[model samples]
Target: MKLLEVKLLTDNLSLAEKFYGKQLGFTRCHLSADELQIEMGSSVLIFRQTKEIKKPVYHFALNIPNNRLNEAIDWISAIASPLKLNSQGEIIADFRNWNAKSIYFIDPIGNIVEFIARFNLPNQSTEPFSVKSILTISEIGLVVNVVKNTVLEFADRFALDIFVPSTSTEQFAALGNDEGLFIVSEKNRHWYPTMINAQPFPLEIKFETDNNVVYNLSI
Candidate 1:
């Protein structure tokens, strides 16, 4: 699956635009006074301005070329500090079983942003990594009240399957493949490598499966 568009909420539009457009080098188009759309490779990341008092932050991951994780890290480090993954001061997260490596960073709005490189994927590039190296929006965390129920609903509604059963549990599940995944996590569960609790806010995702079937999810 591929996430064609992901809509999220934000309270500050100027900062979001400055970070993604000016600093990160992503092209952004202002749809309206309340909406901003950013182009990241094939994916469109949208931020809708909200009047709610509490800011809605989320966790999302971008897929990079299979062999460009290190180069991505170097490129991203110039703009934002790469988050440490462990007390040992390691920045890179090595997911051996998944054949992937990832590094995290916090956006200006406190969103847990990740750039992941899946070694198992055939997408590799000889060019140096940059904003253009981003392949697509691969993952978006959906904080739900019940993981199993959400997983089942997505599977039944979208004809999706669990990505890796062994990597899932009662509290968390990943629906879809490496190209796109809905990370369903129980509410209040701490986000990995951070102590922030997962909280559900309004979000919308438009994605297409490998068979070219498109689906919309709103919550």
Candidate 2:
């Protein structure tokens, strides 16, 4: 399934606007006092105000051209500091795993955001950077309490395939299909927790599927 959009709740709309618009470079598509919308290529990320909400610690990824790995890393580093990085300022590459060039950062709201260039994917043309080219939404991460059967049930309902179950770490589960990936993790174990960062509450996460069925989950 392809993720179309993600709606999050935030107590501070101005802060959200500045962080997403100014810091992350996401363009503001729409805005109101209580609600703000930012466009990331084809997908839209919505932020709304909420009095009582859970601030889940989640990490979502973006895909860029392999050739643009250095460019993407440099661009993101210029805007935000790295959460974890090698001496070269790029995210540490795990040769045994995906082996993608990546970098992770914490947004103003404390959400872990990632910029990645997958190595296995065929290299596309090296074109000038555009929002349509590089800033497209790739994945939405869901932080869960555990890998419970209920979580799998939810995945089935959304037609998501269990790509990889957390074996080495009981704290996480990665589920996806051709559309995109959704990572579910045990709460509190991750860097960001709901209670800590009150802004950017997960409201809805949508994934686009091959059959034109956009899988949607609302929190």
TM-score of each: 0.96, 0.79
The TM-score of predicted model 1 comes to 0.96
lDDT of 1: 0.88
Write down the lDDT that model 2 would get.
0.63
lDDT of 1 by residue, 1-219 (tens): 899999999999888988898889885555569888988889999999988846787999999998988889899999999998878899999888878899999899889999999887799999998888988999999999888888788778888888973378888888888888888889999887789899999999999987899988799
Q: Each model's C-alpha lDDT?
A: 0.88, 0.63
In model 2, pairs of residues that clash are 1-179, 1-208, 2-207, 2-208, 2-209, 3-206, 3-207, 3-208, 55-194
- How big is the positional error of residue 127 in model 2, measured in Å on the Cα after superposition? 2.4
lDDT, residue 164, candidate 1: 74
